[model samples]
Target chain A: QQQVKQSPQSLIVQKGGISIINCAYENTAFDYFPWYQQFPGKGPALLIAIRPDVSEKKEGRFTISFNKSAKQFSLHIMDSQPGDSATYFCAARGAFGNEKLTFGTGTRLTIIP
Target chain B: DAGITQSPRHKVTETGTPVTLRCHQTENHRYMYWYRQDPGHGLRLIHYSYGVKDTDKGEVSDGYSVSRSKTEDFLLTLESATSSQTSVYFCAISRTSGGQETQYFGPGTRLLVL
Candidate 1:
């Protein structure tokens, strides 16, 4: 069973526009929600993360809006740039101390200049 | 880049053969993980180790085995290779286990089985 689901297998956004990627989870036990960014031929790195206790978390141009009651979360990149073009993944971990994280299918985002 | 490296970055093997991928970390983290990435499937956990000589299975551990004899080295072995196992494998490490800790990933090892 897929615990997490992501939308828009591929996305194209104009430069300086907002790029949005959304994810939903089925398990209510999940506590930490994180987004990872991956460049070609490289491993994924942490982009941003939010916990169920918070509604949103922002770091610079990247923001994660989390809706704990709805069991959904999204990533919004303001003023998107070509350099931001890459694959984004959303993941959820059940409770604290969980070893495995359930990951979404993934979204390939491209920024057109 | 977290002090992580995966050896044999790329390999090609035939079915019924044995293949081993190694992940080495310099961070001395207590938690280490092995994951495989494929198209459509973002990343699936294969196995993970919490300490030396201690390991556990993940969702996709049916065809894979792992060993961790030291704090810095983790080994993943495929007893018998298969075409369905062809994918990019990654190793991740975290200082501790919790909801807040961030996982650092290695570049990856691409394996192709024919």
Candidate 2:
């Protein structure tokens, strides 16, 4: 019954290295994919998002590569930094006013200096 | 971040007691929501309101109720608190524009039930 599945519950990467987190969803009806970043004691914030129309979207050093056919998407942090360390969650929403979001379990990202 | 504020940022209550969490916004947006965050589970929507007096349940609406009498306020009530209800709650707002607009979240309210 879990709609979205995320991998590597915890990850560690060098400051200048790349960090990747992956998520897969079973519901094919989901049309929108968004990633959220949450810090300790704070609410989750929107980091990046993608639609089924595009294969990739990049903003600054963050990139979301989406594969609609596979129902999979991955977040890539280019030149990861300590500030990028936090919990990341992948969410999906169906079309129309079905505005409800189904979120993944979550992944804890850590950047080691 | 969208001028959203949640009152009683932290609370600890006894089981069988009633609790209410308030979300106030200055954005005048059309959509508001209540969600709970727990370890590993990320966040799940409990209820949402699209307009004054127009509301609907979300994925996890059991054991909770919500109301919106005005555009600026949304209230979430736990008729009877339970230990399993311990988690951080968040309020968010979004505009029904081109698409499902991005949501802006509040600082969050932490609640504990004993």
lDDT winner: 1
Per-residue alpha-carbon lDDT of model 2 for A1-113, expressed as tens digits? 78999988999999999999999999999988889999988888889888889999999999999998899999999999999999999989887554778889899999999
lDDT of 1 by residue, B1-114 (tens): 789999989999999999999999998988999999999989999999989999999999998999999999999999999999999999999744343777878999999999
DockQ of each: 0.74, 0.68
For candidate 1, the per-residue lDDT at A97 reads 58
lDDT of 2 at B106: 94
Clash pairs (backbone) in predicted model 1: none
In candidate 1 the C-alpha lDDT for residue B1 amounts to: 70
How many residue pairs collide in each prediction?
Answer: 0, 0
For residues B17-109, write the lDDT of model 2, one tens digit per residue. 999999999989889999999988788899999999999998889999999999999999999999989999999997543465777789999
Stretches of model 2 off by over 4 angstroms after superposition? B96-100
